[model samples]
Target: MPQANIDPAIKSVHVFSTGAGEQHKEHRYGSPLPRLLWALTSQSWIKIPVNAFVIEHRDGLVLFDTGLDPAIKSDPNYINSAIGRFLLRRIFRLHIGPDERLHKKLEAMGFAAADIRKAVISHLHFDHVGGIADIPQADLLVSKDEWAQLSAPHPEREWILREHIEIPGAKWRPVEFAPTDDPLFAPFGGSYDVMGDASMILLPTPGHTPGSMSMLVRTGDTPPLLLVGDLTYQADLLMKDQVPGTGDAKLLRSSFAKVRTLKKQFPDLVILASHDPETADILAASHSSRP
Candidate 1:
């Protein structure tokens, strides 16, 4: 079969690894017994990359997620509360360095932190929003439901830390999805067109967190990409309707079904997850395949 040409207007798409870390398999899969057993007997850890996607849109530079902050590993006060710190260690293992900071990573990719005009936040998880402070000038967009969590007392309990998100001088914009006439996005019920050109469309996927979202990127020369943030540890799992250990399983299933429908509609659609190990290689292939 002949290959399809992608949008020439999209200069390039780049993926950066903010850091590399590992989490218990049980924490990634489901159920409490396995996690307890692993805590007691096993030492298996699944390596995953904390990733952020950068798109070279014609209008400006846009980021899918901000990735992680190196401070989490370097600073003792990163988590703030002692209890939070204790829980964090029990759940995962992080291996990050000073050079892995968002700004530095962007610099390594030939982009400046100031070049990011818009940032689509998948959710308020500390790992995803860790670099928001690095780009205070960028318009940070988050779903209204996700932003609402910040107003509740101690959102950090749910991993949505206000201390990092509510930082001074940050441009936070909470957006609501509107009905879309486009059938391609009909499964999502509504969509938010980030660039108003169908180049990047934001669809609410929820499940992992109340306002979790996935980004649909369409370029003339490349297959559409659905950047799902922590929706599932892997894209294959999502296709099989395997819900992760964290998050609302029912909601995850509902979101998973919607994503499956999207795949049915656009078979070549690439679903990119935040923690997926293949994101870097897949993104590189996408770029290489571009016209």
Candidate 2:
């Protein structure tokens, strides 16, 4: 029962939360933004939480985004947080070095490194890919556009690709989500049945990072859960109609529109935040099952 996302046989299933953690560093770097941003987001100041959601499917495991890795796991600098003089380097995640890991948790649930079918990265960012090594056998499923945007000769953020994007081992499967299911996009879009009735629908909710994507999880006749990656850092922000840390103004607005629509369609659906402690609590309580 714990191994499947749904009733297993009822509809093929597999989705994992991997683990949960927190981040308290948004105020220092957030204040410089235009007043309009603060006015729109109502978050001119405050440290925020960074969370990671890992999903498992019948054929593979889809990681919504990678959170802090081993580097930050044992870093003394990150252990202690102060109000002033916050260290950015201490906050930024690094490529997982060794030892500190999430594999043990997965193994405890009877899963092996090779058990992961695919690690779908919502976008190319360190926090989301920190646990890449945890699923060595799985191919890296990422959006070609996202990769292109990050790996472009002149990328917007250099740190996004630095080693994490171009890693050793594992197969990299780049996919393009389609608006109408072209050969390239159909396989990547709509609701994807993992193992059971549980599905991860890749909604093209760009704007957060050009190629940013969000997922919809349906299970147990329960309220659907939408994993909106990085679109908004805080769940309350979405619930309160605020803005996120970073996103193309227009694109963010478009995605925000989707957010409102989804909320209306599935009022009971849990709209999760990747970097919100409250969301992590919800995930731990609601989605604690290994499957």
Candidate 3:
């Protein structure tokens, strides 16, 4: 039986990157920062589209990341947490109108947030999981170890939140892939295969954080798409093998290197970068019907 819920006509698919800013506007374009870190990307902010995905397979539907907090659009300067949030909308030169939240967009497309059965997180960063609250019935997926790390985090680790992880009444499913150092597909080795449905697989890319993952969507036996969350802020950087501009240079460096190799090996995979503007172009072109 063809899955009635998921639009199977769109066999292999992707979601567009929605955000409020640009990448390396300081470095490639021009800004007032002297060092690469501050110049390339804001350590305190990023103008990235929370890249999310929706996959339709024979059995079910799978969602990638949930995206940024809809609240930011209301009060682009509303980061009332302890660490205090950077006004990304202002920093990115984005003017968030009242109507721009993921759920709004989803509802507009004739789908509700609760319709999502599974969601794969690249990492637990706020921008990635900010819309988690909007997704009511999803079996939220992330590395089990990563969840632990997010909860019992290292000191001064100003990113993740316990509330996001332990949302009351949410169906959170922690997935682990450490024991199997096997390649995501087979023969190759390094991640966990979400054991087919042509659904989603979680790659164990632990660098952007302790359990960063790149989502692999298998539409068919011949090809797939790789939605890497913050793996490389830009696909151009990953293609160039250049060390990415990240919070921790060294950690990001190592992670960047591995993904670079993966890209080299599987060039056919449709790759998406959360903050990269290019992803919007690619995804829009791929599924113009939805956008």
Candidate 4:
């Protein structure tokens, strides 16, 4: 779709981290070792941001992801299941202060948590949904495929905790992608426009999880952005077709190809992964050079 055809309802896009964490190098990049083996034995660790993006749309404030919850550190029973808790310790070393909570992060940005009208959840991962509690009034949007995992036997095994997600007063909406003739999004099969004006569109890019999706932000003069949550740790890796250690390899490749095709269409596309540490800088630079 041409830029002129779509209204520029988005004022700005901002990114902030609720916290940071250390994951094994094998997790970020590809590894031959099995996920369990690497989680237990890998010595290499990479620090990553637990990022969330705030889109200043004409309607109201929208969030791409909620970032990590501080209770995961302060509360012993955060994961509930003993085995889940044990596995989590081996997988991640989180560094989040009480002040780094979602509401506090938004406050620092001069926004109230209540100002969030909707949050387009990239997936049902803990880190991505952690801040939902802080914004009970906002609608939490997740792809229908991703939400189906809750019905499966053991979603918690995949680090999808129902206790936190199915909380009281939480507005969880399952999004179904509709057929679109728009050539730019046709390769993705379908899409869900977060805002009616198409300032932001959600595309199903599963592989990181069954229901994983990414957001495409097209505003006025700023470069277009794809807010990919854990599809890849870094944008360059996705460009190289490098699959992470976990998730379905076959499916990841499929999603990677679609995103790569999108990049070719919009040469200046800014691909921002949720955990990519360089996201904030890249976002700033993209806007700084905007025509």
lDDT of 1 by residue, 177-228 (tens): 9998777678788999898777788999999999999998887677778899
**Which candidate has the highest lDDT of all?**
4
lDDT of each: 0.85, 0.56, 0.60, 0.93
Error of 3 at 59 (Å): 2.3
- Model 4: CA > 4 A from native: none
Q: Of models 2 and 3, which has the larger TM-score?
A: 3
The TM-score of predicted model 2 comes to 0.69
**Once superposed on the true structure, which residue ranges of model 1 sit more than 4 Å away at CA?**
1-8, 32-42, 288-291
lDDT of 2 at 87: 33
Candidate 2 residues lying further than 4 Å off, grouped into runs, are: 1-49, 56-61, 72-87, 90-99, 108-110, 154-158, 181-198, 284-291
TM-score per candidate: 0.93, 0.69, 0.75, 0.98
TM-score of 4: 0.98
Q: How many collisions between residues are there in candidate 4?
A: 0
Q: Could you give candidate 4's per-residue lDDT for residues 132-173 as a string of tens digits? A: 999999999999999999999999999999999999999999
Candidate 3: segments with Cα more than 4 A from true spot: 1-12, 17-19, 22-48, 73-78, 86-95, 153-157, 181-190, 221-223, 284-291
